[model samples]
Target chain A: MPTYLTQHQNRFLEELLDWLRIPSVSADPKFHGDVLRAADFIKDRLLEAGATLVELCPTAGNPIVYGEYMAGPDRPTVLVYGHYDVQPADPYELWTSPPFEPVIKNEKIYARGACDDKGQVYMHVKALEMMLRDGGLGAPCNIKFMFEGEEEIGSDNLGIFVKANKEKLQADVILISDTGILANDVPSIEVGLRGLSYHEVEVTGPNRDLHSGLYGGAVMNPINALCDMISSLHDENRHITIPGFYDNVADLGPAERAELAQAPFSAEAFTQSIGLPAAVGEAGYTTPERTSIRPTLDVNGIWGGYTGEGAKTVIASKAYAKISMR
Target chain B: MPTYLTQHQNRFLEELLDWLRIPSVSADPKFHGDVLRAADFIKDRLLEAGATLVELCPTAGNPIVYGEYMAGPDRPTVLVYGHYDVQPADPYELWTSPPFEPVIKNEKIYARGACDDKGQVYMHVKALEMMLRDGGLGAPCNIKFMFEGEEEIGSDNLGIFVKANKEKLQADVILISDTGILANDVPSIEVGLRGLSYHEVEVTGPNRDLHSGLYGGAVMNPINALCDMISSLHDENRHITIPGFYDNVADLGPAERAELAQAPFSAEAFTQSIGLPAAVGEAGYTTPERTSIRPTLDVNGIWGGYTGEGAKTVIASKAYAKISMR
Candidate 1:
């Protein structure tokens, strides 16, 4: 809606395409140099946007890019949080074009990190530049930018950096554009975020894989044992059976529940989108509440024994599963 | 031991070793030539042992080596059943020596089919030779030999061959050395054998893998669904829960059960041999009875989702399991 944004849109798009081509995937160590180069890109862009203090703060993992535009000592401050790195573009064959080679069709850029955080973070830098250079209007408030390079990898180092520099990061409010709104025209915001814990479990039975026909009746198969253990984690009512699992989970009052239910959702559309016959979840809660307000235990992966093209009558020695709780 | 057997024992072992080198693995199609060569070896050995009639009977799969030595019509007939094919030697690294290259180690021959029907079938050919050529001890009964080359692959073609040539295979008694003895000095015989049925199951949830953090509590994970299904196949007491599964199963009487219990058995040794904490089976049956008489259901294999290194928070679109019943 601003004249500055419309006039310099082509240049802004060019800058984003250049950054997207760096392949700054922090999860893989082979991309370490590219990750650092991506940080430098951010540092240069921040400096060009008239930020006074812009530096790359080192950590045990990838470094954090920090920049600041101080209006004055008396003005309220806003801390903007974002990341420069992206999740690995694996199963690359699924993409229509190469991942790092950004392509724009129908006015939408196609790339790994184009949408995630790079696009959003770029908007902040350009907005700051527009206010400082486009018009005579200067900064109305103090703004601190923290663009992390390890956000895609659970942000392992961001916590340490935040703790060590708490005074430097002080602000009246924090703004994060990591999550998406309902629509571009009808804006929406999430009030809360879920915490996650992941774990891997292994069940061992016999010492070696045994012939199913020779020992099936007498020995307990590790796969079957693992299945039995996993099945018991949830009760008949779809509630987690782990002791004290729900003891600390906070319960929202009826008013809050009503407010959450007001979010636009269609059970038919949700089921059809996922190609499920119907939606299923906790017996008492609706689908929206189940995804947002409730904790969940899901087996992300399970494997054991022969899984080839044909049948192999073998009782595997061990079975494993990866579980995640949200 | 007879003088003839003792005198030519070296030659007999040499002939058996040569046959074992053919690599007649019926399970793999890559060894099709080796399988046919194995059948030819059996046919030549039977003829060398003074058999009047020997032929390779053609079938849908591998051929069956049929030979006969008629000891006059007045004597009772004996049908000797065996196989020249061996099970595939896989995970080949586990073998001390090459599977197809026979080796003598510590007075025992090492090969895939050494103790199976190949060795046992060789003994029958050598015995017929010894009786006809040594000390003029001519055959005492009409002996018929039927060595199939598809026993390792469920004997698929053998059943069809038997049904088609029932009259040609007729005999007063059938002798099969396919099973093992209790010891070299102690002989043992099995009165019956167990029947087997195998199956593969698939559980499908969503059309595509979903992010656990976004849809975990709402969507049903296929791995968890498959585990739940597998766990319900047996009851708390380990008895199969399928209806009509045991309708045709026969129960052994108290007298037979007592006789079976009298056989030499050590629960401690059985448990220790397999490196299990303890032997577990159906609630009311002993380990021996469970393996031999009682029916069983086991999940031989289970697989789904990410089974690679580290963790992947994904709810898989599909999960699979292989089950076998005995």
Candidate 2:
């Protein structure tokens, strides 16, 4: 490796580790200050990396970190899309370490935003730095970086920002490294990404938690009702049964399916990697197609009643589920 | 009301409130001292209430508070079954006041275990006091009060205690007042009680929590799996689908069904009281029959990942449910 390249790599990781320590969880109001600090950090880094026209674009939600670099008018323009915010670090007991405290274990960096946009987005800024630092391998292209801070929470402010600033984002093609790859060796590129529609349902029964022994079978239990409703979302064949849920689902012909099926996947190795006896999805599609071509519904979280030490035989008034569809 | 009877009611409520102040949550180990104090309270109260024999019966679990007022073996011996320990007051936010600090609001004495056996059992202790104080109200029967501390849990130690002390517990009949009445003007009685079989199931998928965006559709999510499994527990008609679940279930004769139907109940009032649109159970059974005679299953509690302020998008490793069969 070149001496400057090695030094740049070390500095790049160090800077990212510093950024990762901010805990910029956008969804929670408790981390409001931290989210703002993350935007400031990105803006300062972009300025230090010799980017011109760096600014914090405030929206209805968290501010967007914007920067630009111009090679020449004839150069191809590349617009990069990424986020400075991250998902909330919840179920904190499940995490091995404090989520904001980055740790490297088993040749992998373990943190809430590691390998996410924080890690991916920071690399591009570092690359821009390299082009400015090393004069020989200089950039021959104009680049624009738009890092939003509300992507984790449905990108609530991004649509307005994009519409209001259309001319500033003009480019030949947009670049994004937010999606995950299959493996280090398999150089797979995602041609399309699934859109997300998230929802939460609250099932209620009694006005207050009642003794189950006194009220069982007399009224609906919110937990049982929630479970029944969730179960009905999918049929016996593992197909979603939301009544016209699949009305507009694209139907690929057999020829197209066969072409997609050419991708290699072993069921045993796949399930083994996740410690599952088997994997089940739509009856007729491959695993890759089930995830990519087909939309899927999953329950991200569920809770109700006395989920504590032993048991309380309570018919809780409310049960909740956080559902995500992709 | 009689003069002395009306006067004693005030002090009686005060003493019960004092006893309720001890946080005797039996399910949690942290409340071990409180449980013991509850047992001691009962023993001291029994002695003060003029019981001839009072003792703390030690067992594998929390101790049993025993007291007797024998009017000789010739008279009818009535044994009372009750419990001193209370269920863990969880979801404490639902409470209008701290659970251990008994409160009276809107003509209702509200507290954990205020109605479920604790209040009922304490009334009996007061009844014994009344008999001793009045001397003319009850001298015809021999009474034995047996209060165990693990009834909120499985009553694990009661079986051993009962079996070992069979000779000492010899009585003509068992009288239990662990249930409630309809109203001050109405008289009601429960002929039989539903049996309970509580179970806890833990579903494990991956060895650790993973970012849902990375491994969502690839690996099994325990929350999704749990919802799937719980949803499958019932069928189209809301019948429990466990194999041979209804086997050996006694079929109630038409005459018996008619007799049961004679119990006055308005379906509208039942559902409205609990804030449910409708009541649901087996197709043929009535609400009373489903709750008391026929068996039913319900999830007392359920918990999994990321049930917090914002989204974690975690495919949790473990999911849990506390189910009870009645």
Candidate 3:
């Protein structure tokens, strides 16, 4: 296993870099061809890994890559879920290097999908390859790989596919490698996952963007009204002010809370890492609890009136914001 | 009054166009010089409008323009609050004409800040001029104009200025023309204002972005996790799920709600106005109630992973979102 791991590390990195170069964002329709090309790339890689019955399953949005490797009926069956699609890389100027030009810097592969599910999903493929080379193809697990191309957009069709192909995707436990460690140095398992609600709010004031000087005193500035509305969501204590929001919140006991707090956390270190003044969250909870156990609300993106290069004194006719909760 | 209104209508419109041409966005630091230039423009305009004691008050972020006209000691005082700042105009391609070049089509001025506080606020300035020219300035009120240049950036310094100059800014009723009319033809006044809370959230999974293929099953995609988290904010009924969020929401009586619903509204008309599939909001309330009386949560903006011109199949290490509440 060690020999195989060492022998293929460089080649695996090179192949992954090539894969990263293809723009396969499924969220956007303009990348339809790129997504198809990515599907082909994954199909080829699965075949190279000694997999049989590899095919691209067509869906409403993007294609799903499926393959099977059955050792015997007695073996434990494992189903792997992944996506070849990625999120759109925007604010492109923020990138230190071209996002697609995967680079190896400071022992880390720098690319858009380097450390995300791509790197982790590839690890399992490599593990399967290692088993094949070492004459362990008849290992304990009968592995099945199911890679989709639209998880980034919201696996709109995945649930339907799973329901329809229950027998094909049957497994003891669905093993997914799309999460992260608790920290860079500490390896931890994510036992619980939070749910989400995404929404866009449009606050329309006037019929169109108006001049602030002419309408400042008579009309509502949606941006100002938006800011005022947002400011009132939390009180001085940092608690969300929506009515009945906490009715179903399951509280954590002191013991569990204490154990979670024992995880090594340094405020100074965390602040330095993020380049922030200080960490902020719900007042009564620790940072870990605020992020992991307790639910949180945040503004993901906001724009209404004017968010441009210079300034226009016109009041925006409408202000918009995107919010998320967990 | 009609004569004065008619005489200055075209001139007022032209002058405002010139003012809108100056980009005075205060949120961005690069607009520092432009902001100063805008302040000078306001000062010259105020002088022309017969304002005495007009000066620009400097703050940490943007400058504030203050002016006063003391008609008499016994008259009622009206303090006007406004902002000369505008939002950043981005996605510039979306504009039909240059955001700075104010265009009047179908009797409506189109520009970035045309209908926002700039246009709204300018009406008061024009009204003040009309009052002074028609010898109506000494009619019944002592008007004080307080225009700040940082309203677009959260009014960070204006709050401090307001707190510091409480005595100087005293008035019986603070008349701000920053809101808009309920309908295009019917003039409406905003009697109540909504409060707000805005926040940005960052979710980190791995130390860096990962490839979905290798890491899909083993690790968490911040983008996916963020989506999941966001999806949980509202329930199947679209009500927010945050605990204790609605503790302070003041519910209006049925009569008040009914009266508000009487405002001219049509589902089809509203839908056609914004070019949306349909008008959507909290299930139980009318559109007017949802926008005005009821507190709401929305995702103002959202971004995570790669959102660029091309696709990059990366699970982002971090995902960000902005949320607004009322």
Candidate 4:
């Protein structure tokens, strides 16, 4: 007694559940077979959905899923990009249900790649099937699918494949549905992403852990040395201390900043959410501006030796920091 | 036919090994039984060594093992101090064998209390046995043995026990086997030890870990904040910046300092030993002077958030430092 649209929606959900079951984790070689299975499954589905020239394009790394549907001369061509791989399901004991075993609980499909591309990509495949089956939908654009298996592992092979066959892969524009949305209802469309500049710094003092009591004053502890270096990264006004770091940094005009400030945000709510007495940043800017518009130097992580038990009088040999500049 | 010492040495080692088998770890409550057993074991051994009035002097915490031996008039009274307890062998995984399971590997009696008083203290008990057994050995001093079960823990009850029994505990001077000896053949007696003052400092900025990309430039990270504050503890010239920190510090005369510097030392070997390019300290002082004579500030341990894996873009809520001034 269900309508055709309702049945199609049910079919889409069922198919996605099948795709999510494969633990196609490209980061780990243990999931190599699963990753291959996931890629083949996508290739078969695209062919069944009326895509011609469907093929699993092999590379040195994981294979790429390629398929295209040609329309009449005047239709604009659109290339759709997605990935069939997922991040590693690590600290595996933390998961309530197994990462490979897909289950719908609280109306949310709990799986490794449930939302990250596998779920999002499946929607496009089913939408194309719906239009093909209904026969009432006019062709708005020519479609090309280029799903890779290595996006979760930095997409090493895809760039090589693209550069080698640029003409074959050419399209009007590429559309991607991968960026995270805020929530089901209160979501904002992401136009672009912030580029990240990552650096790892290691400071060495003594070659090995030394007794702090025996060599406390004479030795320079790497933790303390590292802290000193990190402290100097930001000056008195919290300005970055790196030489010429802001040379290429984009600065917005006052009018633009004022317009951006009009966006809804509450500093009080922000403080309460993260549990702070108040917010602090670059002297002249608001919290939002400092985050989005301004460049930042952050210590993503820091570590040394002997961070355990009652006390160990150790001056660590080395200290490491992972800093991100955005 | 071996000497009496050879026979006694074998017996002393067997007895000490039996004592070391008990896990007298005072830091944790689970080892309460072992701690008590250790105290009783010490009392029994002291009595067997011919000490009179051996008693397990109870306190709020673990008991104090007390014993005495007397001689006729004009013998100088001597109080011998030691502890039967050992530090918690945590990071127990780092040990080659179970902490309580004593083993002699590579000519070393490798165990939790091997070098600490269990080994050192056993030497005194056997010497007492040897003197008492010899019968020909003259008594130059009247001895009182005070071995406690709470040295690994801060000797909290021993103070109360000592204060309450001041008259009974009285002696000319205390003979302690606690301090370190330099080497096997080149031994020098340690006359005194450095006084330590430790403090824990906590720096809080935000209430929780925030996404570094969203709140980085605007939010003050506690790790960075802590670093800034710690860096200010010493000026550019390496002089401590704490007001009146060096006010009551004793200054050695030029002649005394020159005499102290005359001790045999190799600057190159010292640097190579600790794997430092060069030693560092206050403006004008040798490494030995900086370590022993002058007071020092050191970060024994420091920690915050996201110290694991490749990268975690988190602005941690709190940063902590365990600082020591000696």
DockQ of all models, two decimals each: 0.51, 0.66, 0.06, 0.43
Please give me the total number of clashing residue pairs in predicted model 2.
0
Estimate candidate 1's alpha-carbon lDDT, on a 0 to 1 scale.
Answer: 0.85
Clashing residue pairs, candidate 4? A275-B207
lDDT of 2 by residue, B12-70 (tens): 78889988888888888899899899889888888878799999999988999889999
TM-score of chain A of 1: 0.87
Error of 1 at A41 (Å): 6.9
- Candidate number that wins on lDDT, 2 or 3: 2
DockQ measured for candidate 1:
0.51
Candidate 2 stretches with Cα past 4 Å from truth are: A134-136, A264-269, B134-138
lDDT of each: 0.85, 0.83, 0.69, 0.78
10 residues in a row with least lDDT, candidate 2 chain B: B179-188
Worst 10 residues of 1 chain A by lDDT: A179-188
Model 2, position A223, has a per-residue lDDT of: 95
Which candidate comes out best when scored by lDDT?
Answer: 1
Number of backbone collisions per candidate:
0, 0, 157, 1
TM-scores, in order shown? 0.83, 0.95, 0.56, 0.80
How far in Å is the alpha carbon of B189 misplaced in model 1? 1.7
Off by over 4 Å in 3: A1-326, B1-10, B134-139, B309-311
Q: A-chain TM-score in candidate 2?
A: 0.95
Q: What is residue B207's positional error in candidate 2, in angstroms?
A: 2.7
- Considering summed lDDT, which 10 consecutive residues are worst modelled in model 1 chain B? B179-188
